[model samples]
Target: MMPVDANVKKIIAQPLTAEAFQKYGQVVSVPRGDDGQSANNNTAKRFNFLGNVQNLRSDAKANMCVFRCQPVAMPFHMRMLEKHQYSNQMFSPMNAQRYLVIVSLGGDEPDLQTLAAFVADGTQAINYNAGCWHHPMIALDTTIDFTCFVHENGTKDDCTVTQTKEQFFVHI
Candidate 1:
C-alpha cells in the first residue's frame, strides 16, 4: 500500500460491465451467440446495434481517429474530467492490455459522489453518452493504440473540461 494525499480521493476500479456502466455509456464487445448473426458465409459474426453515436448538432461531423497513448504511471491522479455536450464518444482498443475508465454524472459539473472507476480489458470498448463526464483514457501496463470516435464542428462545445476541486487517485 502507498501513502495517501490528504485531499485526494482514492478509488478502486471495478471490472467494467454493461449493466453497471449504462448511465454513462455502453459497453461494446462481441455479443453472445444468440445476440449476433453469422456473416460472410459464416466466416465472421456480426453484432447489430451495440451502441449508437449521438451526434446532436446539425453541424457536427463524425470523426474517427487513432490515438497512440502512453501508459500512465501509478498511482494515477485524476484532476479533471471532460464531456461532449452535443455528441457521444467511443474508444476501441487496437492493441491495449488494460485501461481505466472514470466517469461521473451530474448537471453541469461532475458529481464526485457519483464518481465511478472501471478497469477495462483489451477486448472491451466504451461509448460515452452525450454530456457524460469522463476522464481521459488511462492506459495501463504498456502503450496502446486506440481507435477513437466522436463528432466535432470545430467549436468549444465539441469538448468541455472541468477541473475538480478535490482530485481523485486510482489504485488498481
Candidate 2:
C-alpha cells in the first residue's frame, strides 16, 4: 500500500466510439462555422470562482436541458487510479443530461462521428467519455475553454465502462 509516482510523457485523447463505450452516451460533434467562425451559439460564459449559475427548464415540449460544471479540468497527466478500475465506478452516470463538449480553440475539429480525427489545420480538438477521464484540451494552438451541456434526469447509470485509456493523435 504505497503511492506510485509516474511520469506523463504525453497526453492522449481519442474519439469515443459507441463500440468502446456501449450503452454509454453518444458522441455528437458540435457544428463549426463556415470557413471562419463558430456557428453554434449557447456556449456558456466563464465567470470563475466569482459565483455559480444554475438553470433548470421544463417547458413540457421544448426539452429539459441541464448544464452543471464541477469546475474540474484535465490534469497534466491522466492516469487511471486503482479505485476506478475495480468497482463499477469505471462506468456510471451521475445524471441523464445529454452533454456537448464544444471547442473554440484554433482549428481543432470535433469528432462529429467517426474515429474523430481533426481535418489537420494546426488547431487541436477534444473528446469526452461521458465522464471517463479526459485531458481537457488537446492543446495544439489556443487555450481550451469549453462549456459542457449535461442533462437532468433521475437516470443513475448513464455511463458505461470500457478497457482503454483516452487515445488521441495528430493527423498532420
Candidate 3:
C-alpha cells in the first residue's frame, strides 16, 4: 500500500445534521412535531420520504438486513470507498450509540479531495443516495447492530470500490 501524503487530507468530524448531510443523503430521525407527524395510532413518530431507493436495473432487488459492526477507534486511516450504483443504502442503529459516517461526492468515481466525515448520534440514521461514495460502517465506542436497507442482485455490479494509493485518516 502506498503511504499517505506528507499532508494527508484531514477531515474533522462534524455533527450530522439534515441540512449538512442533504447533498449526500437523508438523515433519518424522529422529526419534531412541527416537522413530522405521528403515525400508527400515535405509537410512532414518522419522518417520511427520507430517500429514494433507486434500482434502475431489472435485476435489482430491495432487501433488509442487520449488520453487527465492531467499533472503530479514532485516528484511523481510510484507504477505500464504495458506491452502490443500482440503489440507495440506509443504516439505522438498533442500539443507542454514536458512529462515523464518511462520504464523498463526484458521481460514480468520487474525488478523494471531496471526502467529508460526520458523527451521527444513536438517534440519527442515514440513507446514502444511489452512486454516492462512502466508507463502510464505522461504529464508535461500542459494537452496534444496524438495520440496513439496500438493493442487491448478488453481483459485483451491486457495488463499486475505489482504493486510494495514499491513506487518509479522520480526526474528530
Candidate 4:
C-alpha cells in the first residue's frame, strides 16, 4: 500500500520440505516408501498420485512450458511477486544445482512480514497453489532448466503481478 522503502529485508532460505511448505504449496519428489509399483517389466518404478493440478476456470486450458533460468547472484533482491488466481503453477527442475523459492501470505497483495524462502535441489519439484503469492523462480550457481505446467486462457488474468512495498534480499 505504500511506496517502496530503502530498508531491505534479509531472508535465509531453508531446505524445502513438505511440512514447511504445506501452507503455500506441495513439494513434489520421490515418495519414501515401497509403495511404488514396478513398471515396464520390472525396469522402472511408478508412483501414483504424487500431486494434483488446480485449474479453476472452465475456459482455461493446461499449458506446459520449459524455462531456462540463469544463475542469480547471492543476496538476490526481490522487488516483485506474482500469482495465478485460477490455476496452480508447477516447476520441475531438469538440471539444477539449487534454486530459491520465495512465497508470501496475503489477501490483495504480498505481505512483506510473511515472506518465506526455501532452497530446493534438482531432485525436488514444487506446485504452488492457486492465488499463492511467490517470486519468480530463482536459479542459483548455474543455469537451470525447468519443466513448468499451468493453465491459461490467453488473458492478463492468467497471471497477476504486484510490486512489493519494500525490497527483500534473499541469502542462501
Superior by TM-score: candidate 1 or candidate 4:
1
| Candidate 4 residue lDDT tens string, 82-169 | 9999999999999857899999878789877889999999889999999899999999989999999999999999999999988778
RMSD of 1: 1.8
Q: What is the per-residue lDDT of model 3 for residues 15-114, given as tens digits with 9 covering 90 to 100?
A: 9999999888899887655556778898976666766677768887788999999997677678899998878999999998999999988765787767
- Candidate 1 backbone collisions, by pair: none
Clashes of each: 0, 5, 0, 0
Per-candidate TM equals 0.94, 0.24, 0.90, 0.93
Report the Cα lDDT for residue 37, model 4.
87
- Ranking under TM-score, best-scoring first? 1, 4, 3, 2
For model 3, the superposed segments whose C-alpha errors exceed 4 Å read 1-7, 33-35
What is the descending lDDT order?
1, 4, 3, 2
lDDT (10s digit) by residue, model 1, range 107-142? 789888989999999999999999999998889889
lDDT of 2 by residue, 1-172 (tens): 1232352223334444434433322333323342333334735432222111222323212122322334323332222211111111111123322222221111122222233222212121122323323222233333323334333333322322232233322222
